[model samples]
Target: MSRKHLHVVDSSSFELNIPEAELELMEEMISAYEVRRLGSRNHKQKSVSSDTAVIRSFLTFIQKAPWNATTDDFDAWCYQIGREQKVATNSQRKYQSAVQGFYRYIVDNVKFQAAVLDRYNLRIIQLVTEENKIPHVHERQRTNERPAFTHQDFESFIGAIDVQIVEAYKFNSKEFLALQRDKVMFYSMYVMALRNSECCDLNLSSFRSNPNLPEFGDYGFASVWGKGSKGSGPKQRAVAIDHADLPPLLDWYVNDIRPQYLQKPHCDPNEEAFFLTERGSRMKSGSLNYRFKKILGYAGLSEKGFVPHCLRHTFTTHASSAGMSLEYSKIKLGHEYAATTQTYTHCGDEFVNREAVRYAQSIINRLSDDE
Candidate 1:
């Protein structure tokens, strides 16, 4: 049977002539535009999905207004919705843009009038100004603090995890499968420095055992579907792995744990997800967080203010501490700019002091020779 079609309702008049196919096409176009914002690094699908959600919310609200609604109508709607929902300024801006973009699309493609488009733009600006009137107190407070992690603190955390694993595994009844999985996951996140979503969406098939160019010392690599990769952008990137160092962990996951998990009667091998739950279902963002929290507690680490993204931060920090060049780090992190990678270079004072002492010694020797 054919699926029931979706419709995009015109909020102003409660008109619902938009067909599901048209809505889907419009959503695809908006998603394309959103992915374009990422510049590069291939996260198109994520961007599209985000934009689609934002636009869908805006459309649902807009369709409730009169068909001949004026700028005042749009403005009033924005203020009412913004205040009612207590939406943040950034969120309000997104909604406004979504509404404006939807109208622009209708105008350009559906023969919507210039006047209607002008009204939409005017309402967006008005809403933006209204939203900005509230002071961004939280942002002002956060301006002085950097968002990256420090090398020493990160190492301490890892060391803490190691100690916990030794202690916890001694008493656990479930054979430490979960603990092992978390350790591998944590190591993979730090070693590869993947975004949480990228890690979550990774597929077992993407792990190549005998990757190309093995003679050049190339080892296994993961074909990651990065940001802007879903729609029309770069779909995949081959991230090289130091297989000699990391391969055994992947081997344990794929050959040992994965097989046992998949052998269950209800397991869905075709799900295309690398991570699975105890029930053999595909792992989700929430499950990743739950696992991360459980592991953090087991490792005797404080869960407060700790986020999974910190693993990415820890990777970059440790790499910088090890004297890895910023350019190399940037490339490995899939960052488009050197500055983005620079944020992760929170080296400890000891590193700075050691470098300073070396420099001073070199200067002293040179001066003595000159005398």
Candidate 2:
């Protein structure tokens, strides 16, 4: 447990005439919570800060300390906060979990719970429960609202990028190299099943030739720092680069366009970033989102509500359609479970029916051959 104090509330907004001992106890509790987060949870600074903020906001809303807060207080605060912030149900769930986790930590720690009881004669109980918490059953599972790009839409999107790259090159535009980079970036996201941050964090050393995939040269697989489960850390994995066009495009960009960017006056000679900007640094996630929208507009699919993550989903759905097994797709996408990968597979009803017919035809042909 740490002695560092947490700013639980603004003194000006909510004044409380409390004894020094009680205030000290509250501060100690917050410090201990932070210690648990840092040591046991392995939470990063952003996660720790966000969790603390949520706890502080909940305490402020309840107008009481953690031990004194009740389910009614939690319910009231949850409702008011959700309405006031205009956050989605998922966001509300996160807020609830943060507070809920704090309660759990205090309740489960026998020494801490005993101290609070001995001094203040009060006990903290878990406020968020299965009944009270906002359900994620429908949101996480079932059909995802974030639709994957249909095959035709993907083609149109890539084709539009191609036209932009060619046009930029022909005019000797300053953005010509950027357009080429964007082509590889976006296509790689789709084919490699990369998250936006993962794609941006890529280094020149990330790609290596898979001995089994020698034809792809050194671009056969991309080793990415993948998104982690919980707040653990970056999960690294090698995604196989199977798409034919992807290897050549990536090779061209790396050997040709990438060097040109590195030669910019302000560029760092030793910069290892695979995706470099004109400013001589790694490409930021925000820039990726902005470029994605621009390309979406060019593809005439801007109104379809597609996002960068949708590219991963598009790959999942498209790969399954192209005969990739569910288990293999899960491995390639670095998903923890096959069930999680299943959620990303959003093959249309038409495709399902087509597959059904094809399967039945295969069975019939086999029976006829036996006869």
Backbone atom clashes (below 3 Å) for every candidate: 18, 0
RMSD of each: 9.1, 6.3
Q: Give the TM-scores of the predictions, in the order they appear.
A: 0.59, 0.73
Q: What TM-score does candidate 1 reach? A: 0.59
Residue 12, model 1: Cα distance from true site in angstroms: 5.2
Model 2, span 252-305: residue lDDT tens:
988888898878787888999999888879999999999999999999999998
Q: Per-residue lDDT of 218-284 in model 1, one digit per residue for the tens?
A: 2277777765422346346766664255677777777687666677788776667777777777777
Q: Give the TM-score comparing model 2 with the true structure, all chains together.
A: 0.73
Q: Which ranges of candidate 1 are over 4 A from the true structure?
A: 1-87, 92-172, 209-219, 229-235, 359-371
The global C-alpha lDDT for each of the candidates, from Candidate 1 onward, is 0.60, 0.84
Consecutive 10-residue window with the lowest summed lDDT within model 2: 1-10
Candidate 1 colliding pairs, count? 18
List residue ranges in candidate 2 displaced over 4 A.
Answer: 1-32, 49-70, 76-92, 106-125, 136-145, 164-176, 228-235, 334-340, 355-371
> Deviation in angstroms for 364 in model 1?
5.4
